[model samples]
Target: MIWLVSMYLSSMLFLVLGSVLNLGLSLLCLEKGLSWFIEWEIMSLNSSSIVMTLILDWMSFMFLGFVMFISSMVLFYSGSYMSGDMNVNRFMYLVLAFVLSMAFLIISPNMISILLGWDGLGLVSYVLVIYYQNEKSANAGMLTALSNRIGDVAILLAIAVFSGSGGWNFLFYVDNMPKSDSSWLVCFLIVLAAMTKSAQIPFSAWLPAAMAAPTPVSALVHSSTLVTAGVYLLIRFSPALESSNSRLMLLLLSSLTMFMAGLGANFEYDLKKIIALSTLSQLGVMMSILCLGYSQLAFFHLLAHALFKALLFMCAGSVIHSVKDYQDIRMMGGLVYHMPLTSMCMNLANLALCGTPFLAGFYSKDMILEVAFMSPINLVIFILYALATGLTVCYTMRLVYYTLSGSFNLGNLYSISDESSIMTSPMIFLSVGAIAGGASLSWLIFPCPYMICMSFMFKTLALSVSVIGGAIGYVLNMSAVSYELNSIKLYNETVFSGSMWFMPYLSTRGVSEKFLMLGELYQKVGDNGWSEYYGGQGLYFVLTKSSGYLQVLQDNSMKLYMLSFLLWVIVIFFSMI
Candidate 1:
């Protein structure tokens, strides 16, 4: 009890202090238009040097503030969510380590230093994902770790490519780097690293799988830490991408990720997976927008999404806890009647996610959509952006209908209530941010408003799609007992979308099946077959048989040995004669 109290109080204190300090520093940097680079020489050799670098700028400060704030809430909430678990302390420590890794990544503008934090985030997140000690958790952790490992390798390759520049700090080189083969290689590597970390398409299967972790961790991972690291890194590397053709490729991949996630979420029923898919969708939005040359908007959305998404996850945690650990939306209904506060917060976060007017998502999402519409993007990208925006609302509305509006669906004996203040307190705290974070971040991020001059139809297109999507989503999910599900009618399409377009299969079994089969063949022909006959086993068999024959001769009587010796001597004499 004492340890738990100490952990909670200490985390809250740090959260409060960190948030205030970072916010103040961010404002000061903004006011002065300042960026401070502090370098400490670790060692110097002949004609070369090694140093650690830290950069303090408005972006770093602001991102740090958001991260610390959300982490504080998550830790506090974990005190209750994981209270019964025996390894609660271990969980708290892992969460802190995760925050530390993110902080390192946030403050370092150098690729070498960033890799330190980058690898740390990946390693720590794998540990966190597997915290539950179950097969699902283990598999999810492996997927998460291996997927991020690709990014780690890309970063290492980028570091090698960056060696030619004589400095590991990319901030100085990104804008001024000359166009060369090495430069393009470095850019491609950075983009690959970012895409994998951000869980962009082909690499996105791990994001939802990661929900196997504790829900509090999900709030932190999806909202601010693990997933956002990629977008944040790319924000720092935006200059490199801006000049390269890689931006087009990133734009296409990210937009597809966005559309796929949104579609997948609409078919998803698991509470946490729905939210996870939403996070992936939002990440795609950030990456796509950044690729379109609006890193600030991407950063703004990242911050705002962190706020509401954290709140959303916390609310989901509350609901999941109250419902006896059931995560299926089908198992939950009329939750508002039991946990009004939680339902309200969940709905608020959902609304914010949908980019409802004047909310945090609206300020950033609305601007991003407006900018995307006005950009010289092709028609396919435009259609994807528009449809994805609608699907966002579609899933939110579907979730709301199933969880909040339906009749009580749990077994009659189950009691559901949001009586845990330890958990609810964090939700309320973040609800304030969810409600106002967008507008606040908008004022701070964009000193000048985005000048989006589009026709009336185009301007209102997002709003129209959202409204129609929400209505359809609600009406479709709200079914009579006699009515069949549309999903049943469109089974193939539903399966594809719900399955993330078979990406998880492709990522896990689909990709591994052939390799696993090859391994089996090797085991049959080499390790167990040919190698057994001619390798160590075969040598052992030959030596064992020779030893047995020698033992037989030694065990023979002395008379037999003498007679054999006489016969051998006579034969030798006859041959000599």
Candidate 2:
């Protein structure tokens, strides 16, 4: 037990040191335009050899530094969060393994090695998602795993098609690939794989469901590690997708995902699920920016978002723990009076999420929106981006109103206090990062600022939308008023938004029910009915009748034997004549 506790502390220290070292390395690389890579041949194939390769450029180093920092905090928090469990040591080990998998993903420059990390992330995350070993956890785990399996399959197919390059190392050919049909197909498949990992559009259902995992896992995996893997892939392969038609398709789908998730977040009430949906919305933002040919900006947002989001999840976990495991925000109110520090952290994270000026989200999100406005995109894309930006503020304000302010809504108000030092300490550390990460990363990522030509109206569009959304959120959740909106009485609209447009039901039950019904029909009509009768029963009847005739012929019954002998003799004589 002592060793386990020491392990968490020691690992946290190691990660902190590593992060600082990597940060220096990244700065050097950025200044010098230097990249380091190492490769070793592992196996010899027909013409191409399998090799393990590691890459260290500005992007890889910076992302690695961020991942390690967040992961270290998550592990530190988990020591307190999971201390009561008997499997706490095992949990720590798994978390370490998960971090290592993410590291593998970050440094690998080859497709095959990337897949190793990719699949490792998926497998470890599935286990983490179902760590509680309950029915809900199990079901959510399956949903998470199966959704990612689509990406795995897509990657396998991509490898098969890309084999024409005579090797699986995409970094070498990404810039030199021929403009052929196979190349286009490979690009399309790569986008498809990214969509799955990032939980974009049709693949979006699994993310919120995965909130069934423990809170520390949620903080690490959903916020920083697993979810960002897809965006990183897109950022790496942006060169290949620059001119492909798939870029347009990605832009359309990702923008829709952004709008849909933001709207859904407004209607969602669960504390963790709202955060999960917010993660989804942010992912959409990253993907959309990547589609718009701004990979550096996308990567910048990815890092900034990771900092605040991990902080956000940790804060949410703190609140949930304080309220006796209650996750519904409707039941939580007046928490600010009791848990001051936690509420402050939550508010800061929420404000950052809303892209408040000078905060972490402001740095990257503002840049992305500004770039979007200046890009040669159609009005539909522009409008969706604007609306989604507004909706982000709207939902975040709604969450704050329900969870922190207003009267105490819990049935019995027990004395609720802040968490122990073990938990709050990590939250404090992340809160600092969430506050300053954007500005720091902005300087590091973009040495030269982005120049945009737009009207004053376009310049303030994001802030205006945020203001309007904040107003709407306040009015909708005012505790002083007893007014009810008749619009909410409309079951269909409410159900659609509240249920994320029924995405979870459609992805899980809708598909599963249809397939299950098909299986039943097959059992009744084909297997039990036709197959049993025609194949089994028909064969039994034919064999039984033949056996009966043979038995009669051989039974030595005098009349039967004599009749058979006479018929045979007559047939033989006629043939001879």
Candidate 3:
């Protein structure tokens, strides 16, 4: 117990120290407009160098600082959340490994080095997801791992493509690389990889499924470490993507992802899954804006979202811990009366998610929507941005109505309270960030605010949508014993929207159903039927029968030996004659 406690304390301390150091370095780099590359040559083959490289810049340093800060808080939170588990030490180690993986990804610009971190994040996250060791966790872990493997394969392909350029360092190549088919292909692969990591559109099922993980791991994975890795990677690759047509596709897909996630969250009842879907929605906002060539805006949103999302998850964890492991928001009501502090933090986080004025989300999310409005985009993209933004608030309001308002529905014997100081401390710390992170990041990332000349109608459109969405969300969720079952009335639409447009089904069963059936047929016909006669089992039977005949011959060896001798003698006499 002491050892575990010490491990947690040390990790939190180390991460906090790293966070402070990186923040200072980021400020220094930003002030001087400086970047440094430290490269060590691993080998050289045919004029192409295989080198391990670390990149230090304002962007990398600031992102690293955020990652470390969140990691520290998560570690501190975990010390209480998993305090009773026998495998707390293992969990701590996995979380540390996860943080280390993100660190590697944040600092490396080389494809090879990035893959090391990228793959590490995927592998470590799988372990963390399955930390609970249940059927759901196992399935979720598998889905998460396989979905991310798509990105790993893409990075490998990019590396193979980059080999033609005589170097694997993408930092030096993203610009000034002559426009060519190879360059286009590399950009496409990079986008594909980023999509898989960020859980955009078709690749998005795993993010919600991964809520099967422990809440602390969810806080880490959903916030700064895993999900944002793709967005961060894209922010780095935005320069190259600018010239490629893939950015347009990314914009459309991310917009759809945002809309789908927000719609799904409205229908979701699971508290953790609701939050996970919101994370997905926020990720879409980042990706879409990045694709629109506002990488700084995307980066700013990423940092602000990280702070609140982590706080949100911690608050969710505290609530779950008190609620006897019940996660359905329908079962939670008037939680503010039972756990005031957690309820406050959750409300703060949700408000941030909704882009409430002056909050962290407002600083970045509102700006992204405005910038998107000003950009020359199709009507479809514009409507998507608008509806998705509204849906974000709608679901957030719905969640609050279900979990924080109304009457408590649990049995009288159940007692729920926020007594865990360790858990609430992190929540309190991140609440500060959730309130100020956006404005602070806005100032740091943009030396001067973005100036956009737009009509008044366009300026208020985002706010109008948000207000309408929130009102409808709260009013719709107000339930009574006499009320009609609207969800039942619109069953198909409910299922379609609630299931993320059946993306989880498509990603898992729809994709593998035919292949699984094929394998079953092969097992019956090949392994059990025809192959039994010609394959390994058949060979085994034939060898057994041959051995039996040899045994019979040996048993009758004396009589058989005499007959053979007589035949040999007769043959010898005929040859002599």
After superposition, the stretches of candidate 2 with alpha carbons farther than 4 Å from their true spots are 411-413, 479-488, 515-577
lDDT of 3 by residue, 1-577 (tens): 8887888889999999999999999999999999999999999899988999999999999999999999999999999999989989888989999999999999999999898899999999899888888999999899999899989999999999999888888988888653656888998999999999999989999999999889999999989999999998888888899888899899899999998999999888999999999999999999988988889889999999999999999999998898889999888888889889999999999999889999999999989999899888899999999999889889888888888887778778878888888899899999999998888888888888557888999999999999999998888788522468868888999999999999999888998577679999999998998988899888999999999989988896887889889999999999999
Q: What TM value does model 1 have? A: 0.90
TM-scores for the candidates: 0.90, 0.89, 0.90
lDDT of 1 by residue, 85-112 (tens): 9988898999999999999999998877
Output the number of the TM-score-best candidate: 3
Query: Which 10 consecutive residues of model 3 have the lowest summed lDDT?
Result: 478-487
Q: Order of all candidates by TM-score, from best down to worst?
A: 3, 1, 2
Selected candidate, larger lDDT, 1 vs 2: 1
CA lDDT, candidate 2, residue 547:
99
Q: For each candidate, how many residue pairs have backbone atoms clashing (under 3 Å)?
A: 1, 0, 0
Candidate 3 residue runs with Cα over 4 Å from true position:
479-483, 516-577
Candidate 1 weakest ten by summed lDDT? 478-487
lDDT of each: 0.91, 0.89, 0.91
How many clashing pairs does model 2 include?
A: 0
